[model samples]
Target: MQANTVEQIAEVQRKYEELQQQFRAEAAEREAAAAAATREVEQRKKYDELQLQLQQMIQMF
Candidate 1:
């Protein structure tokens, strides 16, 4: 292949690798956000349950 053609191919390959890296990073960030949301929901549920139990105990006294 000609030198110019080879250079063009190399440039394309570099751009593709950069895009792949960005895609992976974005996917990781999304996964982390989803996990955090799940944790928050779980904590809220626990807090509500505790509050309910406290109210029940107070009524007994």
Candidate 2:
């Protein structure tokens, strides 16, 4: 009976470790996606500014 109990405890610990690892991987993936989205937003802002400047220059001609 004691041996069975020990085995069960070990199994539980192993599962806990696996879950922790999975959570870490998911968090990292989310962080990377957020960073990419931020970069895209910055790029769009720059593009819009450039477009506005081009329009203004054309109007002066």
- lDDT on C-alpha atoms for all candidate structures: 0.99, 1.00
Model 1 TM-score (2 dp)? 0.90
lDDT for position 60 in model 2: 100
Estimate the TM-score of every prediction: 0.90, 0.88
- Per-residue CA lDDT of model 1 for 1-61, tens digit only, reads 6999999999999999999999999999999999999999999999999999999999999
Residue pairs with colliding backbones in model 2 are none
lDDT of 2 by residue, 3-57 (tens): 9999999999999999999999999999999999999999999999999999999
Cα error, residue 20 of model 1, in Å, equals 0.5
Candidate 2: regions farther than 4 A off? none
| Model 1 CA lDDT for position 4 | 94
